[model samples]
Target: MTKTLFTGVLSLLIASCSQQDDRICEAVAKAPNTISECVHREGYLLADAEGSIRDVATAVVEKCRNHIIQQLLSKPENGPSLEVYATAIEDNAVEEAIRRVTEARSGNCKKPE
Candidate 1:
């Protein structure tokens, strides 16, 4: 019974995370500039606290970069040619996210623990 309860709780947690990701991604799709804030707020740190700012930034990008791109491409406004723009959009998002993280880190803001 304990195992079953744990599994159920885990499943709910996973679902909630996915839902949160979806909501953030959708917002990103509407406002590309918010990518950095969203990433910083919601992204999981792939680096230890000792890692450099750039390293932590890169890790943040690696976390949700794809999901943002996917959300952008999924928009109906883009239609069929959205795939053609995917590369450019992704490139911009990555750069923006990295830049944001770097700036935040430089401001003495602590990376998530």
Candidate 2:
């Protein structure tokens, strides 16, 4: 009976974590600019515990950066210059998201012991 209860609890926890991750990803995809809000929402869902927020944020940033790079590269007529690419990256939503993630990781969203 004890083993069954433990198994059930573990299953529920895993399901809850999966749901939270899905919600976070959806929010990021819907509004990449609103990364801070999404991070806060996920933090709340996880009770401010270290719950894959860093990993999710990193993945989001990488995907956004790759998409931007591809878009720039595809525009041969525009002759994408190094300065332009640097500016685009600096002024992008992904940078803001990464900053927020760093702040959150160092601040209130730290891993629980």
Which candidate's lDDT is highest? 1
The runs of at least 3 residues in candidate 2 whose Cα sits more than 4 Å from the true structure, single-residue gaps closed, are 1-59, 76-80, 96-113
State how far residue 97 of model 1 sits from its true place (Å): 1.5
TM-score of each: 0.44, 0.30
Top-TM-score candidate index: 1
Provide the overall lDDT of each model, using Cα atoms, as 2-decimal numbers.
Answer: 0.54, 0.48
Model 2's alpha-carbon lDDT is: 0.48
Model 2 pairs in collision: none
* Residue 9 C-alpha lDDT in model 2: 99
By TM-score, how accurate is candidate 2? Answer: 0.30
lDDT string, candidate 2, 2-109, tens digits: 999999999997766444242223222233234344433333334334446555555545545545555555555666686776566535644555555554444434
